[model samples]
Target chain A: MKFAIQINEGPYQHQASDSAYQFTRAALAKGHEIFRVFLYHDGVNNATRLAVPPQDDRNITQQWTKLQKEHELDLVVCIAAAQRRGLLDEDEAKRQGKDANNIAEGFRISGLGQLIEAGIEADRLVVFGD
Target chain B: MAKKFLFVNRKAPYGTIYALESLEVVLISAAFEQVVSLVFMDDGVYELTKGQKTDAIGMKNFSPTYSALGDYEIKNIYIEKESLDARGLTLDDLQHLVWEDEDDDWAEKDSIHLVSSKELATIMADQEVIITF
Candidate 1:
């Protein structure tokens, strides 16, 4: 099966971000294909390149980057949500006349249409959030 | 018929408009003759509790609205077991017969299903479309 995951909750408030990762790993282990991972609402925080977790904790950003690199997953961060939360990529920061980029490399800022597209293409669309 | 996964009630059914708006969408989807199923998870599960006293909140206790689902022939209602357990509720405490256990024998219920998180994932995987609140 091909899966498209929708992660809506933020990193701090809920366990959704971690759940998405866990589900992704499980789906991959099952030998299922992943179409994309769409990050909306607080899930956009997972795409931040500047996230610094405590020394004793796991780094979600780094984990996501590694997973994407290994599997070539499409990590899509909603552009509308990212802009509202001050998570900007290089192109968006330049377009909005910002000083620097904040989004990680493996992630791309995109529109909700990509979400629609994911739904159309993938056999399964799993949503993780509150 | 196309199986449309209509996610009704996203909010707590009081504070935010997401829940009500989602209901409208679900009704619309059902009107199209699509096979719709509803899952109440997270704060959205509050919408299912019976005998809600919304008077203090200056709002109508919309929990009764669930009873009207039968009128629309929208019988595929599913509630997360963990959600009800967290709130200290049972299936009898709800306005409608929601599933208490994911693997609970629901063959007796009329078009109603009780699903665990894992079952919900499988159902979601098989659906043609999903619209979250």
Candidate 2:
């Protein structure tokens, strides 16, 4: 199966990020193909490279980074959501007159149109929300 | 072939417009002779609870709209079993009829299959379109 998952909420405030992670891993383990992982709304936080959780727990950012690296997943964070939340890539940071970018590696800031295209193209688009 | 479409509702009906908008979409899709299915998950399952008092919000209660699904031939309504159990709700308490995840009643209702999240994933993969609210 080919799937697209949408994450639409923040990490700390909701379990959406965790659910997305679990679902993605499970789908891949089942030999399913993940067409794309689109992050929108507050979900863009998952793409923030600056996020650091407590040492006692699993770091979702690092986990996602590993997933992206190992599986070559398309970690797409919505550009509008990223800008609003102050998460910028190096290019976007420079364009916005920022000193540095905080967006993590393996994640690219894109437009909502990509989400629409994935929704139209993918066999299934599962949404994870709070 | 009529397209099989599923609307996954994840929010409450009142506080946000997502629930209401989802209902509208289901109705519109049904009108087009599409096989529309509604799966209420998480907080969205609360939308079907009976005795809703929208009067506090100065709005008419819209739960009744769900009861009219039969008139529109949109009878495939499903609520996640885990969601209901987590919220301490039962099928009898909802405004409209809903089958549980393990319920065999769906088979009696024809091709409408009440399913678990695992089955939902497979069903979703089979569908032509899926929208999340």
Model 2 docking grade: incorrect
Record all residue pairs in model 1 with backbone atoms less than 3 Å apart, i.e. clashing: B102-B116
Docking quality level of the chain pair in candidate 1: incorrect
lDDT of 2 by residue, A24-52 (tens): 99999999999999887678888887877
Encode model 1's per-residue lDDT on A36-129: one tens digit a residue. Answer: 9999767888899898889898888888899999899999997877887899988899999999899887989987667766766788888887
Give the TM-score of chain B in candidate 1: 0.80
For model 1, residues B5-65, the per-residue Cα lDDT tens digits are 5564446888864575456445555555556678887677787777889788887665666
lDDT of 2 by residue, B50-106 (tens): 888887788667788777666566667767778878888887677645333335553
Q: Could you estimate the TM-score for every candidate?
A: 0.59, 0.56
Candidate 1 steric clashes: 1
* Model 2 Cα shift for residue B47 (angstroms): 16
Residue B104 error, candidate 1, Å: 45
